[model samples]
Target: MGLVAINLLGGVLASLAFAFVELRPSLPFLFLTTLLVGLILGGWAATSSPLAKLYGGALTTFLILFGTGLSPLPASTPESFSTRIGFVLFALAYTLCMTALLWRAGRAAENSRMA
Candidate 1:
């Protein structure tokens, strides 16, 4: 539940940052909010155990990537090719991380049963 709240806060901060950029094209240092959001997410990731941290990191990356793709950024604003590539790469990485985490968790559970 705390992780979910952190993720939601990060997402909201990200959305606000993007909206600010869209509304004030002339503003400088618009990335500060985004940077803060990253820090929050980093803290969240750091709170978990090693394997769980990897899962959390991958989950966060996947959510950010997929969320950006789905966000209602102005229709007039076109997505660059590199952004698309990033989305795909993160999706694949997330899948692999999830698989590994699940395997590790299952192995631990089995070992506990055998013990």
Candidate 2:
């Protein structure tokens, strides 16, 4: 519960920072931010109970996907084919990293509980 609260607070801070910063056309910064956010949330979810982890993981994944999909391009400007492909690849890589972090954290939490 404490972990979740901290994660949520961090997320709020990140969102405010992003909102104030001028990130237009800054693909690299956006990508890095998303990666960081996903990893933090994933790690937090891993520390939760099994059922909470499942929901947290799913919600985190969805938010990551949705945010990345919408952040880079304006609605008025239709994304080019290559740009779409790039977003897909970036999302895939982000997902994999988040999964790995969650897995490691979960294993550590479980082992500690057993001990």
CA-lDDT, candidates in order: 0.54, 0.54
1-115 per-residue lDDT for model 1 (tens digits): 3443334443444445555556765435445544555565566677756544544554574457434643557643326323643555565567668878999999999999999
- TM-scores for all candidates: the values are 0.34, 0.35
Q: Write the per-residue lDDT of candidate 2 for residues 1-92, one digit (tens) a residue.
A: 43444344444444443553344637786576656666766776777565556546444544644354456465422243225435545655
Worst 10 residues of 2 by lDDT: 76-85
TM-score of 2: 0.35
- Score candidate 1 by lDDT: 0.54
Steric clash pairs (candidate 2): none
lDDT of 2: 0.54
Q: lDDT score, residue 11, model 1? A: 43
Clashes in predicted model 1: 0
Model 2: number of clashes?
0
